[model samples]
Each structure stands twice: as C-alpha cells, then as structure tokens.
Target: MNEPRSTYPFIARGASAELFDMGGGQALKLFRDSVSDEMIAREADASAHAAACGVPTAAATGQRIWDGRRGIIYPRLEGATLMDWISRNPMRAGWALDRMGEIHAVMHRVDGGTLRSLKQVLATDIAYGPAPDALQRAAIAYLETLPGGDALTHGDFHLGNVMMTPHGMMVIDWSKAAAGHPAADAVRSEMLMRFGIGPSDWVTNLWRDWAARRLRRSHAAASGVSTRDIDAWRPVVALAWLRARDATGRTPAFMRYLDGALKQAGLPFTG
Candidate 1:
C-alpha cells in the first residue's frame, strides 16, 4: 500500500474517482471509498483485456493503495476528450461523430471473453429500477428473446469517454465493459448522447438529437448492424437506465422517449 507523494500534482475529479499526475508520463486514478473492490478489479482487468485484444486504450500499468483508497496507474494520455473537442469545434461535430461511430464499430469486432453478460446486467437493472413490476417483468422477458453475442461492449461508451489523442482516438474508462450484442451497446450510446446529463436548452437538445442520429447512421454502416436491431433493444435498455440515472436525466422528455420506445417495441407503457 504505497501512498502517493504529497508533491504529486492533482489533475481532476470525477464522480467515482480522482486523478493525479504521477510524473514520468503516468497518471493515477484513485477511486473513492464508495467504489467497490469488485469494480476496481473489473476496470483493471477489462482495460487490460481490451488493450491486449487491440482496442485503443491505456491499460493500467500498476495498482496501489493510497491513503486506504485503491488507485490504478496508467500511462498519461495526451489530448482532450472527444466531447471537449466537439465543444471547441462545434462545426466539425459531424466529422467527429463519424469517427466515433467507426471506432465503436471496430471495437465491437473484438470478443468480450469472460466479461459479464450484457443481458443479465440489464435484467438486473430493470428488476431494481423504478419501472412498475409489470413493466419490469415484461421488459426482462422481452430482453431474453433478443439476440445475444460475445462482442465487446463498452457499457458506458460516449463522447466523454473517448479521447482525441495525437495517436488517434483512445477510449478510456472500462468500468462497465461487458459481453453483449453490439446493437444493444449501440442503443445505449444513443440514449447517452441524447439524454445523458447536460444542458437541455431547446437548441442544444436539437443538436444533440441530430448528433445522435448521425452517430447511429455511421455506426450502423460500419458495423453492418441495422438500425432495427438497435431499436429493438431500446425499450429494455431505457428501462434499465431508470435504475441508475440521476434526477436531471429523468426529464419529462426522456420519460416520453421511454414511453415511445416501449410502445414501439410492443411492451407495456409506463402509464
């Protein structure tokens, strides 16, 4: 349990972890006390697995306990997150989204090997989520009928999780990696881009909707996964999301979207 030096430069903080510049081109991701050992282990293992399988990500180089908190060290990656880049270069959002879609397609080509099943994860979330028991039961039953796959799915893939590095786009944060159908993962990405926590002004939302559409088209083209396949998974995925989403993400618009998806999929509506 080596402690980080007091001189280590603090970098940034996220909901679950804090980052520090450890010099020598390394960075430490120190998890908060609330983060479980299982999650930390999963992220380390998943990141290494993704890198070994040719996914462009920074694998954990080492692990340490600092001040009783778990930390993983990774080679410092240089560049802004794809989300940040898009914010700064709004006019080039389409190009950036195209690249994001292509990269995601490439990632799905790899096998998830031994990672947790995506369907099971979703079922669990739906079971514990805010949906009515009837809806939860129906959603889980329908989810079982959907096709399954071993493709590597970045459970939380989004623009914010990808970096536009000098070397190219590199994905970060493997905490939610899973083995699942690519289309399901694609649907999750759509939800994130369209409804994840962010500014919700009418103009911003319109752009977000457009961006989500562009990304879906690009991913579908590159992956040979049809929009129908993605759409089929939307209702269940949206229901599962209710378990973990914050209040800001529970807007009336999102509820309507969820209702629409459920209706489209022939599942019981939230009403």
Candidate 2:
C-alpha cells in the first residue's frame, strides 16, 4: 500500500482507495497505484459536469500528490449515506428509495455533452475482460442495438454513492459518469443494488432485493421512464459489470449474477 502523506489524518477506507481528513472541511481522496492519471482526470471532469448540471456533489478543489500517490481535494460535507440511513432506519427504507429516485430523475434530465460515451466504455470493458472473443463481440453488438440519447448517466449509481448532506442529498464518485441512454444508467443501478460485492446474510440479501425493486419503480416514476426500457439493458449492463468485478478478482457471487443476467438477455454466458 502507498503511504498516506502526513498532511492529513486517515478518515476512512474503501476497497480501492482511502480518504483522509484534510482539515478546513476538506478531504483528500488518495488512490491506489493501479489508478491511472487519466482515470482521475475523467472523474474530476465528470464531477464538475454533474455540479454544473445541478446535481448536488462534493466541491472538488484540486488534485495533489500525497506520498507519491495521486489524490483529489474535496470539501468534505457532513451527512450519512443513503445506505447508512437505510441501515439505521429500516422502517423508513421506502422513503430513502423514493429520495434516490427523485435525485436520479434530476440527473437524467440533463445533457451529458462531450463527457464520455457509455457505449464505448462498455465496449472497451468487454474487449479487455476475461470473456471469450465471441461473447465479447455479442455483448458489443447488443450494446449497439440500444437506442442512443444525450442524457447524463451516472455509470455507478447506487445507494452508497448518494450522500445525504446538510444542504441536501449529494452524489460522490464520478469516475464512471457518462453520456448515454438513461436506461443504461438505470439498469446499472439495478444490478448493483441486487448484487453488490461483499458478504451478506440471507436477511440482508432479501432487504437489498426489496430495496432494489423499490428503487427501480421510484426511478421509473420520477423520470417518466418505464422499467421495461431499463430492463432491456440488463444483459449488457451485467456483462460490463462482470468485466469490472473480474478485473478486481473479487465478488465471485456478483460474477455469477452477471452470468445469469447474460443468459436472461439471451446471450450465451461466458463466465
């Protein structure tokens, strides 16, 4: 692991990165060595774009190096994540799901100009993934058949990414933001909600499934989009997610979920 610079104290840690309290209401998001400079730039640009489009987001101050690791400076806001709220107040999970839908609706209405293409990203993932060449070609072909649009899609939208702040609910992590069909974005959320990485008890899985369905309904209503449309992208989204999890070499269960999703989409499973 790369050592964190002493300028800030450790705040939290995630699978791929670490957060440090930088004082002055700011935080440093130091990334692992595997993260490339280009990836960081893409995330920064996407964050700026989301903020400009009226989506609540952390204020990205600038980028700096900490102990030879690349990091971004952000104004750390006070609030619990939607996931935290759900876990603490299970009875009110419905409310949290509704809020998620409302916020996501606001995002889909905006045009994602010149940011990045969701199609291209999926195509690249498939090409580089462990799947056989035939499966990769089929997935890419399926992606091409989908309708295109200019809507802003948070490529990794899920409960954990939405931070409920004093101001309001704000989004974090713009590494996967892209311009494409809203259904593509919606399907990605569904997949993550249904089968995320990490261990979980049966009860937790049940609650997650319920919450995921609620989220889908609420998002469809708020955005005036149909679940049928979002569901159509399920297969392609699953394949792309499989490539992501495979790269991490974790979440074997999630990999299985993707395989099932692929089969459901009428594509051959290549796990």
| Model 2 / residue 22 / CA error / Å | 1.8
On lDDT, the candidate that comes out on top is 1
| lDDT per residue (tens digit) for residues 1-271 in model 2 | 8557486778777765798988988988988888878878877878888888798887578998878888999888788888887778888889889888888889999899887888888888878877788989988998898887788888878887998888878888888888988888888887778777533677777877787789888989989888568766877877776566532323565667767778877788856
Maximum-TM-score candidate? 1
lDDT of 1: 0.89
Model 1 agreement with the true structure over 152-271: per-residue lDDT tens digits: 999888888999999999999899889999998998898898888778888988988898899999999999999789789899988988999852734787889899999999999976
Clashing pairs in 2: none
Worst 10 residues of 2 by lDDT: 242-251
- Alpha-carbon shift of residue 9 in model 1 (angstroms): 0.8
